[model samples]
Target: MMTCLCDAFFDDVARATHEVLESLGIEVIVPESQTCCGQPAFNGGDWASARQVIRHTLNVFQGDCPIIVPSGSCAAMSFHGALLAHEKETDLPQVQAFGARTWEICDFLRNGLGIESWEGRLDARVAIHSSCHSRGTGTPEAIRTLVGSIAGVTLLDFTQPEQCCGFGGTFSVTFPHISGSMGRLKIDSVRATHPDLLVSGDMSCLMHLNGLAEKQGSPLPVKHAIQVLRDARVTPVTVQ
Candidate 1:
């Protein structure tokens, strides 16, 4: 159950998550009918619409294998936001039950499967951007743990790593100037880390930061943490 507000990046993120799960020999069962987790409407303060989306999504993924999401925002929406909405409404008992099963990728890996280590190496410098949703959901440490599992990868710590990248779906559109300024600040923080790769759990934040980095001609490459972990596992092993 991977939900992404940005449809353009959802498949890529889902593929990355699936690839990692496969590499680890973890069987995944993706429901054919799952939809968006409704973070967009929820973030915009449109709880009514968000509840509708939530009900639809919950009904779709019904009996689950621990609903796993690639995006922290979506996971937060499923785990906390939807549950909050359900609490406020009398007609969403199913939504509350489904929310209990939701887990972010790193959260699933760290807490669900207890994956203390991974079996590959990137051999490069990387900086991790802790997204606001991830922080709010208490999964930043889980991300760090997972990143640390990869061999020969140096994970640099950025100052104010939890700052929002300003891509809160409609936030960028409704407040372009503010969003752009916040994005610039995030880019500057990433730049200050001087990492060869910038990684995050949320594709939205990565896309926002990546766009700014591209516009500024920064050499840093942006990628999802799952992508990097997948790359490490798939890269041909060398023997001395």
Candidate 2:
């Protein structure tokens, strides 16, 4: 799924996801009617509005095919959030079925495609931010394994690797001070490791951290995991 954040802010990440998936020979189908996963409303505690949005989402994305989502937050919202939105309704069964078909890109790459490691190389020290919503999704392991597999790619250790970057959809806007503080803490932890690039499955986290890092005058470079993979997979041309 091209998340609203990726669609709006990180079009490159969306393109990278499409390129990587197509490279794997997967017949990618993007329904034009697809919209936000209703995570903003859900996270904002507006179940009524979230249900309205997710119900439309459920109708738009109607195939039994695997629905690949790049963001853990949005992917989790599909199964977990949608269930909460449609609780006790007749649509619960369909929501459950939709959740079953949903897969985060990293999880799908590692498990669904049986890709254990990357043959390509990217010479950089990478720090992974396992987004808060990535929990229970098998994304942590998938991210570590995939990044660690690339030749010349060193996955560095950072404090609180599992910590949230403080972009909880509407949470950031609700409490900007707390959000900025949490973001600073995350940036500090990542800076301690001296990473060449900060990688994450969720662009929302990267967007928050990168912005904070820049405001603090550090400018932490970041990329979605799929973008890193796409770069690694591309064979560098010989100018000579």
Candidate 3:
């Protein structure tokens, strides 16, 4: 799934995900009617609107094919979040089936495709920020395994690798001061590692961190892990 954040602010991330999936010989199918996974409303305690949006999405993504989502937050919402919305309803069965077929892209690539290693090369000291929503979903481990498998990429160590980037969908806006402080702490941890690039499974987290980094004048470089893997396939031509 192309998340709202990715589609609006980071189109390249979705493109890179598409390219990487195709390179692995996976035929991707994106339904044109697909839209938000109802996360914003769900997180905001608006269940009526959330169910409306979730129903529309479920209709768009019908069938047994695995629904691969680039953002762990959205993937979780589509399945687990949707199930909660329809908990007492008769549609719960459908939501459970949908949950069974959903997967975050990295998780899909690692466990779904059985790809333990990527032979591509990109020499850089990389630090990872697995999204808060990715916890318990196996995305963190999948990211470590996949990124570590890249030949020349060195995974850097940093404090609080599990800390949230403070972009909890509407949580940031609801509590900007608390959100900003949390984000700064996360950035400080990453900066201490002195890595060449900051990587994450979620573009939303990167967007939040990138804004704080620029405001603080540190401006650390960042990219989605899929973009790193896609770029690693190429040979960089040096200008003479």
Highest-lDDT candidate: 2
Report how far off residue 67 is in candidate 2 (Å). Answer: 0.4
Each model's TM-score? 0.91, 0.96, 0.95
Candidate number with the higher lDDT (1 or 2):
2
- Put down candidate 1 lDDT per residue, 1-240, tens digits, no spaces: 766543555577788889888877888887777668887888899988988888888778877568778878788888778888778688667776787888888888888888878777777777888888776565777777887778887888877866788888899899999998999998887788778888888888888777776788864477777777677788833221
On residues 132-166, what C-alpha lDDT tens digit does candidate 3 reach at each position? 88889878889889988888788998998767889
Compared to the true structure, candidate 3 yields what TM-score?
0.95
Compose the digit string of candidate 2's lDDT tens values, residues 1-240. 798988789999888889899999998988898889998888788888988888888898898999999988888998788888888788899899998899999999998899999768788888998988989888888988998898888899898766778888788989999999999999999999988888999999999999988887878889899888888888721111
Rank the candidate models, highest TM-score first. 2, 3, 1
lDDT of 1: 0.78
Q: How high is the lDDT of residue 169 in model 1?
A: 84
Ranking by lDDT: 2, 3, 1
> Between the candidate structures 1 and 3, which one is better when assessed by lDDT?
3
lDDT for each of the candidates?
0.78, 0.87, 0.86
